[model samples]
Target: MSYLVLARKYRPRNFGEMVGQEHVVQALTNALTQQRLHHAYLFTGTRGVGKTTVSRILAKSLNCQGADGSGGITATPCGVCQACTEIDAGRFVDYTELDAASNRGVDEVQGLLEQAVYKPVQGRFKVFMIDEVHMLTNTAFNAMLKTLEEPPEYLKFVLATTDPQKVPVTVLSRCLQFNLRPMAPETVHEHLVRVLGTEQVPAEPGALRLLARAARGSMRDALSLTDQAIAYGNGTLAEAGVRQMLGSADRGHVHRLVEALAQGDGRTVVETVEAMRDAGLSAASTLEEMTAVLQAMAVLQAVPARAAQQDAGDPDAQEAARLAALMPADETQLLYSMCLHGRAELGLAPDEYAALTMVLLRLLAFKPAAEDGATEKKTLLNPAPPAEARPPAPAPVARAEPPAVVVAPQLPEPPAPAPMPAPLAAELPPPTSAAPAVQAAGQRLPVVDAPRRPAAPTAPA
Candidate 1:
């Protein structure tokens, strides 16, 4: 009849099919296996992270009859059973899916609660699944409070919200809450590869990786982007086509930008930005791509053995490793910080490409002063004060040391000259007594003559 999107086609039907959220799955599976069923459940997380999916699976597990029609409460539901199939197709009589975002008034909530008084018609329990429950009004939340807190034994409440903080505590306390975490990049990557294989699509590994990273931990988003990438590549996904589709610069360009920054080459940085602008690529995406490379380079720099074993055949890896060697650890940290803060300023700038260019050049401005080939290298930050800041202190210190040695020999020489000049005032030259005149100022005006004559008589006596 109609083409099914990959997101819906590959939706997780059971807890076992769920990826990247084992802790929640384990707890729910054990609870179901032990028959410890809660009347109400709350699933909270960001959008596209399977809040609705888990709610449906739990609904099926509660109601599924086996293929032979005898199954009761199970963690895994047999998809062929009428109960499971209906739940999967959203046609089950007992399961009610509400979009609280659209119907958030008290009237809508009161209407849903009105049905809780009745028992299940086609399943073991009647499930009320409200997606984006946080969007409901305060009065709406108040209307559901009494019924949600103490619902009929046959009724189950499944509340899902992306923003749990907005959910009222009175309603929250009545249900068992589980938070679904975002998927890891590796997990998303592997899942994309599996999907492409099933579709008979020949996608390059690099293309899948770009999709995985671009997905930012959303499997549905990843699959959606993959569909677009496939179309962009004309049903054959290649790295070049995917890169163009995402408007990302070549990995080679990212490498060159980082390599130039590490080498403090401003011209290369400017030219690279120019090339990206000319190619009509996004400035933010270019910075985003460089951020990824800089992160990897930091990782490589942290682990040298890993750097040595980088994929020799891959040009991107080779360039990254080469940059890892060229950039010291501190500068790597600096460049990483610059890229992070620069991305935020792009919108405020008049020309985003000019902002991107300035961002790339910022690394050169912050280049570690130690990297400069100087015998006395100064740090770019925390520079030393000028040597003459304390001019008086050092001047005295330098001059005070030499006079100590000069004074020792001169102390004995001066006394001998003083007595000799007095004893031989008549035989010796007047200059012999001149040395005492230099010291006579403290004693008297004529002490040079007066004291030497008196000292000459006292010495003989």
Candidate 2:
């Protein structure tokens, strides 16, 4: 018998098996029980967040039959029925799943829509499930708008996409939309524990926590990673193995680095980074770990009681709280921002370890001085002035008066006449008869003269 992977083997068969999507499940369950079904349904979310799974479960709900083969539309499908079994196996005649990513042209869409007129061949309803529906072309979308908006009573449409924004508003308006949120780490962790228990695989709690955080809220990814971890650990998942597999820095190192940074201990910071590098740990991962610790420290600093209550059982939480108290709130925030942005700098540098060292040192370089240290800094920057060699103040001098001279009045100078062109000078009239020359001795009249024109006549002769 061929072995099925955990993701496929444990795929949810009905709404009851779905996880991390209570809001969606409740809404759908109520709608199903009341028979308030829409012609078109759109499920949107990130990858592996149950978009496709929800679509399959919805299809089974529409077509499920009881063991005795006498069932109507139901919120819970009987997996034993031919309709439910075939749909789960992906071989149902009426439940058609189209991968829009590959067959996104108008011809394919029209071909699929061509079947909308026909009745169901083997089930109560004909379900057309289109995955990654956003990949469909504009023309393809337009091709099915009329049918999607007004489908037959026996026909239903299920569209799923990671990016709902790419889907045209026209198509979006024709469907009932449900956003499936990413599962929380805690949710993923609980699910993994159940899954590993079923598989009879022994995994440490710390290892599971690491996997959950690494999964970043994807159940499918968490399971896939568990499969890899089990194989790597030879069926036993341990913290050290998972850490090495993930190239994650140890919490001890992260805590040490944070403490060193808080205390302005550069040597410890450098040593911690070197140890991480020696262990072949990722620089980016180190920064990521520091950012996480700093973030926790910040939260604990901000709301100590609440954070304590939330992280009461976490082994590292106590240490985080300790560091939170040790470092000032402002410095914690500053380091958090630096570590967050420092990850981007790792790729730009030639050596990632060296870059990590620089990023850590950068926080120390910019760390705010303490109150006592501020005074010391001021003294260093501006020392006291010398006292013995101070210069003496000078005496004020007496004012003196200048000697008086005999009075001698002077007359104002006369104004100069303006020059004129020779031709204009020749054409000028004599001084005005109305004016009296030398009426005032200080005012003098100036004469003007024009150049001779005799040379012109001599050349002609």
Candidate 3:
């Protein structure tokens, strides 16, 4: 037998064999079991999310004969029957698959629609599986609209696309659409373990983890990478080998970069970049990993409950929680945004490693100052006047003492004082009991020779 790639070799054969996309599977399974099947079914999702796989399984479910050739339509397909075996071998006469990407023309579409008039030659129903159907031109789409909306009873139209937006809404409304979600890392990891175990291949858990993460939620991609890893390891999968093959930095390096960034250690970040360069790791991959870590941290900061419920044994989750606690929520979001945009900057810089350094250091640049409530520089509202050089305020000092006198500017002499009445003069105190005198605005009372001279003057007279 010729060598088969892992992606094809481990391709999901039936609904039961599929690992992810349980929601789509459940709906389709119920439809099949209850025989509430729709004539037109549309599957949409990214590549490797089982868009085509689901269509094939549905075909098998409808056409599979039981072990003794006595089975009617079922949710579970019996692989022993002729129809099931032929479909699995991709030689079924009634099941047709069209690659719209290559044959996206009105004539091609019209030719496909013509098959609806004929009945299934070998199976219970004829399945027209169109992959990447969104690539079909508007004219091609128009040609098949009537048939797609109302196909023959014995014919099932399965249209799959990665982008549903490109597919006309008119056509979309005619089919029962089901979206297949990308597989989770854990789900992909478990599936890789199962496949490796079945192949009797010796593999390390860490290697499988790296593969799962590298897959980015694509089971086909995950398996294909595993095949490369196994060959790279010469039949054994090791973390070190897989990491080298993927050209990603060591997990510890990513953690250290994140921790250093959270602590605002620019020196450590730069050194990490140097270390990664020395290890020959890809700069793009380093940023990629950082983006992932930062995103997880953001989620942890945003929703604590969700992060708390994450699997305890997952080191990535634990580290994310720790980082989220270490950094403020706003900082977490900032770092995440920078890392995401940094991936594009790697190519523009003079050197990618240098760009990586800047990207990591960006967080430190925008990070708030230490929250320890210690002002970096003391700023006084009114800085204490240079009190050492000058005495205390003169206003307060002057208020503490009595003013002897307040002299007015020099002026002309004032007019002489007038004589007092005799009755008022009798009420005056002795001359020895003198009171202090004050001058009016610019006038002074002049002293008149007392009447003392009057007695002497009378005697003289």
Candidate 4:
């Protein structure tokens, strides 16, 4: 027998078997139970999220007739019915599926609409399912509008698109649109466990967890990876085998890098990068893995209880919690951001490993300097010198004094003077002073003698 690929082999057969789409399932199931079925429906989501799978299940539900040929429309179809079995096998005549990606033209859409007028030949209702409906052109979309809005009572339309924005509003308005969400890692992991058990594959839980994360919320992707892991492990999955097969960088490398960042060990960080390079691991993958670890660390740090609640089998989670305790939450967030952005830089550099080495060392370069050790000593020694002082001068003494006063000597004078003249005669009588005119009448003159006064030495008179 030929080997069928895991993606096709594990495809969901019914609504109950579909994973990670409870919202769509619950709504459709309620609608069926209430008998309020819409003539046209639309399913939109990312790939592997069960858009097409749900459409098929819905088709089977609307068309299935029981083995006794007495059943009516039901949410849970009887698989024994010809319609359900044939639809599950993709060979039902009443159900038609179109890959809009290939048959997306005005002519193809008109041909599909032409079939809407005819009635169901065998099944209860004819189902027309279009996959990737966003690929249709504007003209094709225009062709689909009228039939989609008012289809024949015996016909149902199911349209699926990975990108809904590309589908026209005219087309969107005619159908009841439902969005399917991507599965969480935990949901994907649980589903994988159920699948592995049914396949009788021996696997470690750690290996399965790794596969779940690698799937990134796509069950089809998870199962495909699981098949590859099982084959690599020869039907028994081991963590080492799975990691080696996926070329997954070891989480220990991430732990060491983060611990070095927390402890401010630049040398250890460089050494860790060198070790990763020696082990032949991709630098981009290392940074990506480290970022994942740091994110987990931040979560555990924010909610301390999560540290205790982690699965011990995942050494990475334990390491994340440990690093979270050692590093500040702010630093954890910073390093996580750096690691994520650094992955893009790896390809731009000439050597990716070297670029990765620089990225690892970048955190050490940014580590804040220590503040308390050597700066305090210089301020204490060698005090300022004292100001200078001068001496005072000596006081003066008193001297002896002299006593009393003394007299000085004098000098003498000399000589005589001329005598004065009288009025008439020197010695006339004192009674009458003669007049000089009478004496002068006679011409010749009378020489008047001076009335002499005695000149002598001066005396006290």
Candidate 5:
């Protein structure tokens, strides 16, 4: 046999072997054990999260016979049985798999429906497994509705799709739908370790962790990248080799870059970018790596316990935590925003290194300057009006009067002002020896009279 690819070689044959998707497995297992089988089933999730895998497992569970050929429908199939072996090898007469991506026409759907009428050749039930069923045409879906909703007692329909939205709601409502979520990084990491162990391929835990993250919740992708890493490292996976293979920036570099950004060290940041460029690392990858680091920093800053638990396996968790402490929440958010936006700048710039340098420097540029220096710079550059231009505000006046009215009132009759008001001096009376006068505004001014001089005082004058 041609060298089996790692993905196919390690394809999960049983639900117990599948990684993640526990909710789906539990429900299916319970249904199988209770013999509460649905005529039609729909599995939805991103690629390689085990939608098709679950379908195949269900097929085997329904048809498998024990080693002595005495088994019936069961949640756990005996691999030694003819039914299980044939299904695992993809040679089962009763189990049929259709690629809707290729056979998506109405005629193809009708052809498959025709097989639904016939009974199982040997097994207790006939299984129809359709992959990428969402790719089927509207007319094809219409053709499938009747049979899918009400198949024969001995026939089962299993449909799998990465996107369930494309599947008609009418069809979706008729089937037992199970959504398989994308596997978490930690879950993917553990799965990789198991696979590598089985293959006897020595791998660094950190290397596997990086592969898991890069896979983005896809098992096939994780396996494919692991294969590449193994090849790159001559069958022994190491962090340095995997990083080189992925063209991914190292966490050490990412940490240093973030630290410099947090500390407002523009020179160091630029120098780091220069080194990355010299090493021929991708600018986009640099930004992406930094974004991941910033995201972790934010999470750590927000929930210490959660971060502690999640980062327990990470060798750099302490460094990451320390960086989180040194960086403020606001700056962390800012740097995250910059890294996200900087990814787009990579394609626009003539040289990615220059783009990266500017992107890293952007954070430093935004750092708040000292209050005194900032104020002085602002004042010197944009000085306020001189004293002559902006004279001291006129002394506070109680009521300001217009020197002259440019436009008179529009009333038909002019306002009457015949009364001659007393002068301001008359408004206030002279001070008297008996009663003193208060001259301030709004105060009562008392009348005053000079005291009469004696006759002897007049002679002396």
Candidate 6:
């Protein structure tokens, strides 16, 4: 037999086999048992979250016959029946899957609708499963609106799309919508363990953990990566090999970087980046790992009790708790923000490693004053002076003004200028009352005009 990739080979055979989608499964199961079926169903979520899988299981439930070929519709399908077996193999005539991404025109939609008029040939109900239904054009969507809103009792519609926003609201209104969320990393990890156990492949827990994190909540992606990791490791999965394949930085380097950052040690930070570069590690991955570690540190700092509850076996958690105590909460938050945003900066620089170095150094450049030995500088620059040496602050004066008018006090005229001394007066010419006043020695007196001078001048003219 040819080789089968883990993703396809381990595809969920039924709803019971599905993981991390209990909410969706429970609702569908109850609905199936109660026979409360909608004419059209819309499954929305990110890629590889089992939107199509749920649809297939639902189709099987509606068409399943018993092992003895005497069964009616059921929540659990008998996999042995022709209808269930054919649907699983994708060869069932009644279960038709259309890849809307390729055939997204009105013609294709109309052609599919033409099949709707006919009843099921080999199953209880005719299922039309359209994958990536969001890719269908507006005209195609409009053409199917009427049929989708009110389809025949024997016909069923199952639409799956990664982007539900693009799926027209008109179609959305007619169908029952269920949003399948991405699986948690822990869920993906546990599922990987089970799948690998069944495959009889030996994998380290750390390797599986790395793969789960790299999968980013996609089980299909997790399985696919496991297959690659197994191949890369020559039949067994190891943390070092998986990390190398994913280009993920070592946790040791990440912890060292965080510890260096917490200590405000720029030299250690630079040396760590150099070691990472020498090892051919990705700068982006380093920042990504740093962000993760920093986030945990921040959480631990905020909730000190979380440290006790964290996985005791996980060295990363213990290291994070140690660093969390070493760094202040505010600095932890600042570094987390920087590392989170620094991933985008890696691509903008000419050399990604150089950019990574700058990003790491940025935390030191903006280190908190208390941590950077600036607290003393702040105190020295703004020290309080002695009371006597300090200039007193000016008191605030209240301003009030009198009316705009002035009056001078009256005084009796000085007693006729107190008659000059007789001897000094005699030395001076006789003074005219209006003009002349005697002065003391070395002081000059005003001159008085002689009365006859004007007459003498007039006679000469």
Per-model lDDT: 0.85, 0.88, 0.84, 0.83, 0.84, 0.87
lDDT of 3 by residue, 260-308 (tens): 8877788888888888898899998887887888888888777889885
lDDT of 5 at 238: 92
* Runs with alpha carbons beyond 4 Å of true place in candidate 4: 373-461
Residue lDDT tens for model 1, 1-461? 99788999999999888999899999999999999989999999877788999999999999988889988999989988988999998999999999999999999998988888888888999999999999999999999988888888888899999889999889889999999998888899889888889999999888988898888878889999988887888899999899889988788888888888877789888898888888999988888888888888889888878866765755667777778888888888888888899999899999999899888888787665553555233455866578887355544344444332212112234444444454466765345444442333234333234233333445454
Going through the candidates in order, what is the number of backbone clashes in each? 0, 0, 0, 0, 4, 0
TM-score quality measure for candidate 1: 0.81
lDDT of candidate 5 over 147-196, digit per residue (tens): 88888999999999988999999999989999999989889899898889
lDDT of 3 at 288: 81
- Which candidate leads in TM-score? 6
Candidate 4 weakest lDDT stretch, 10 residues: 405-414
lDDT of 1: 0.85
Measured with C-alpha atoms, the lDDT of residue 34 in candidate 4 is 86
Mind giving the per-residue lDDT tens digits that candidate 2 earns over 22-76? 9999999999999999999999998889998999999989999888999989999
lDDT tens digits, residues 168-229, model 6?
Answer: 88899998899999989889999999998999999998999899999987888998899899
Lowest-lDDT window of 10 residues in candidate 1?
A: 403-412
Residue 353, model 2: Cα distance from true site in angstroms:
1.5
TM-scores for every candidate against the unseen true structure? 0.81, 0.81, 0.78, 0.79, 0.80, 0.83
List candidate 3 segments past 4 Å from native. Answer: 298-329, 368-461
Note the residue pairs that clash in candidate 3.
none
The parts of candidate 6 lying over 4 Å away from their true place are: 369-461
What C-alpha root-mean-square deviation, in Å, does candidate 5 show against the real structure? 13.6
List candidate 2 segments past 4 Å from native. Answer: 370-461
RMSD of each: 11.0, 10.9, 10.4, 22.9, 13.6, 7.9
